[model samples]
Target: RPATVDYMSVDAEAAEVEIFRDFPFADFDISVISVEVQAHNYYELDTIFVTAGYAKLAVLGGDHVYAKLRRPLVPPQGAAEWQRTIARDFHAHAPARSEIGRSQ
Candidate 1:
């Protein structure tokens, strides 16, 4: 099912409180950090492409995740394979674009 959806940001403090209160087990077992970085460009690609790129970096970056940068790749290559190579190369530098911003 697909429909137009409106999006909003949740208060991070409230979200944390709720998660801890309702799912205490989850909190103790988990560490979650959310970051909002600005990519001032339109991304017109499949969800798989978008998500795989981020996840690969998150896992490989080892610490500084959430992508201070992202790179675009064309297809016929496997997502995981490309992501591995990208994570290695990407770690050295931040995203270089026309303009970039970071939002908490």
Candidate 2:
């Protein structure tokens, strides 16, 4: 029943995928998410987030994957313009390659 979560971090040991599956991605406005996953569960976790309209931002320390929502979240009145500006700036400054520790 949570409405908006700006960021979420999950380190659920072996239950990372399950926890992500249970999260209401469509019902809530989650801007960013990071999960600690084992090698066996990495694909499954990636699938869930990609299916939920998120794009992989980075893979940290091999096990932690970070993602951001593909689309912009609705902003409060008087903040929409500011949000758009920030988004533009972010995209401009974002890394050329999303993932880390990967051969270019």
Candidate 3:
């Protein structure tokens, strides 16, 4: 049951996620938990885009799997604002950068 689902750890899987740091995204104490309960399932973590920390994931499967963002999704926003938000996060907490570096 638990195996059917998956989670992205953020730092571990940054490159694969579609995000921007220029904007702003609030972080949650707990990671977004995605689940899978399908009777039968087949998936490859590599084939799919997943991050270890705060990245969005794309799982290959049917309704059997369910996903919930432990970190709530940001409210809708304009394109430029959204891009900045993603870029900011990516630049700051991206697996590559240090948390301190982002605040600047």
The best candidate by TM-score is 2
TM-scores for candidates 1 onward, in order: 0.23, 0.59, 0.23
Superposed on all Cα atoms, model 3 deviates from the true structure by an RMSD in Å of 14.7
The residue pairs in collision within model 1 are: none
lDDT of 3 by residue, 8-48 (tens): 33321322123322212233233343334232322332213
Q: What does candidate 2's lDDT look like per residue over 4-101, in tens digits? A: 87888878878988888877776887877777788899888888877777877888875555556555343445467878888999998877775656
Ordered list by lDDT, greatest first: 2, 3, 1
Which has the better TM-score: candidate 1, or candidate 2? 2
Q: How close is candidate 3 to the true structure, as a TM-score?
A: 0.23
The root-mean-square deviation over C-alpha atoms between each candidate and the true structure, in angstroms, is 15.1, 10.1, 14.7
Candidate number with greatest lDDT: 2
